[model samples]
Target: MKIHIIGGGNLGSAIAVGLAKNAKGNNITVTRRNIGFIQHLTEYGIVVSQSNTEGISEADLIILAVKPHQVDAVMAEILPHITNKIIASVLSGITLEYLNKKVDGTNTVLRLMPNIAAQFGASATCISARTADLPKANVVTELFNKIGTAVIIDEKLMDAGTVLGACGTAFALRYIRASMQAGIEIGFDAKTALAIAAQTALGATEMLLNQQVHPEQLIDKVTTPQGCTIAGLNEMEHQGFSSSLIKGIKVSLQNIKSE
Candidate 1:
C-alpha cells in the first residue's frame, strides 16, 4: 500500500511510523512545505520529504495532516494533482464539506481524531468517512488498528472525540503526577515515587482491560471501610475530583467547539 501524507508533524509522523512498522510493502511519503520531518522519513524514501509540487504518484490513500489553518492552502496546493482517491484528514476543525469544496475528483473523504499515543502504536482514533468513501473505510480502520484502537463515529461527533481521547493524555498524566506526589509526601524518593505511581497507573489501566472491571468496582476492592485507602478516597472526593474532571472535560469540549 502506498500513502502520501501531507504535513509531517507529530500526528502525521506518528501514523506513518505506525504503518511503516506493521505493514508489508508499505510506501509512505510525508510531504509538507518544509522538511522538518524529512530526516525521519529518509529510511523509507527521500522522495516523500521532497516537494510534493510535481504531484504524488498513485496512492491508496492521501492524508492531510496539516494544521487547521493550513487546510485550505494545502488542499489548493494538492488540487491540480488530486486524484479520485481516499483522503483521510487528521486536522482538527476542518469539516468534510470544506474539503470537498477545495479538491475535485476526491469524494472519498474521512476525518480522524487520534491521540498522541500513536507514536507507540497505542493511540485511540475515531474515523468518519463519506457514504461514497464507506467501501474503503475499513482499510483505514485496519491501518490505524495497527497503531491503536480505532472506532467509527459520526462526523458531527468528531470534535467531541478530540476533546475526549485526543486531549485525554494530559488528563491521565495529571493523575499520574498526583499519585507520584502522594508517594513522595509519604516518604518515597522522587524516582521511586514516580516509578511506583506510573506502574500503578499502568497496572490499573491493564486491569480495566484484562479483568474488565468497572473503575468504581476496582476502587471498592482497594478501599476497605475505615481503611487508609478509604480515608484518602474520602478526602479526594471531598476535594471534588469528580467535579473537577467533569468540569475540565466539559470546558475542554466547549473550547473545541468555540475554536
Candidate 2:
C-alpha cells in the first residue's frame, strides 16, 4: 500500500517508523515543514517531503497527522487533488463529519487514535467511521494492526478511547516513575530502581493479558491478609491513586469534548 503521512511530528514519525518496520514493500511518504529531521526515514524506503499536495497526490492512503487547527489549511491545499482514496485523521477531536464537509463528502474518511507506542509496534489504536465506510475502514484497521492492536468502535467513543489508550500511556509511565522513585528512596540506585519498576510493570501487564483475569483477581493472589502487598495497595488507594486516575481520564474526555 502507498501511504502518505502528513505532519512528521512525534505521532506521525512513530506511525511511519512502525509501519516501515512491519510492512515491507509499501511505499510511505512523510511530510512536514522541515523534512531534515525525518530524512532518516528514507533509509527504510520511506519518502520525506515538505509538500502536502505532492504527498497526497502520490499515495493510495493519506494519513493526516497534522494538528487539529491545521486540518482546514491542509484540506484546502489538497482538496483539489484528492480522489476516492481513504483518508485517516489522527488529529484529536476532529470529527468525520467535519472532514467530510471539508472534502465535500467525496472521500472515505476515518478517525484513528493511537499512542506513542506505535513506534514499538505496541499501540492500542481505535478506528471509527460511518457504517457505510466499513470496507475502507477495515483497510485502515488492517493497516494499523501492522503496528498494534486495532479496534473498531463507534465514533462517539473515540474521545473515551483517546483518554484510555493515548493519554493512558503517559499515565502508565507516570506510575512507573513514581514506583522508581519509591524504589530509590529505599536505597536502590536510579538505574536499578528504573529497571525494577519497568520490569515489574511489564510483568503485571503480561499477567493481565495472558491470564485474561480481572485485576482484582491478581491482587487477591498477591495479597494475603495483613501482607506487605496488601498494606501497600491499601496505602495507594488511601492516597487516591485509583480515584485520581479515574478522575484524570474523565477530565481528559471532557476536554476533548469541549474542543
**Candidate 2 on 1-259: residue-level lDDT in tens?**
8899999999999999999998777889999998899999888778899998875766789999989999999888887998897889999989989988887777788999998899888899999998999888998899889898899999999999999999999999999999999999999999999999999999999899899999999989999999999999999999999999999899988897887
lDDT at residue 2 of model 2 (Cα atoms): 89
Q: Which candidate number maximizes lDDT?
A: 2
Which stretches of model 1 miss by more than 4 angstroms? 43-48, 53-55
**What tens digits encode model 1's per-residue C-alpha lDDT throughout 1-259?**
7788887778887777767766646778787666764676667442456565454647778888888898877777776776677788999988878776776545478888887788777888999877777667888988888888898888899888998898888999999999999899999999999999999998998888788878999999898889999898888889998899999999999998887
**What is the Cα-based lDDT of residue 259 in candidate 1?**
77
TM-score for all models, in order of appearance: 0.91, 0.95
> The CA-based lDDT of model 2 is what?
0.91
| Candidate 1 similarity to native, TM-score | 0.91
Candidate 1 residue pairs that clash: 121-147
Task: Give RMSD (Å) of candidate 1 vs. truth.
Answer: 2.1
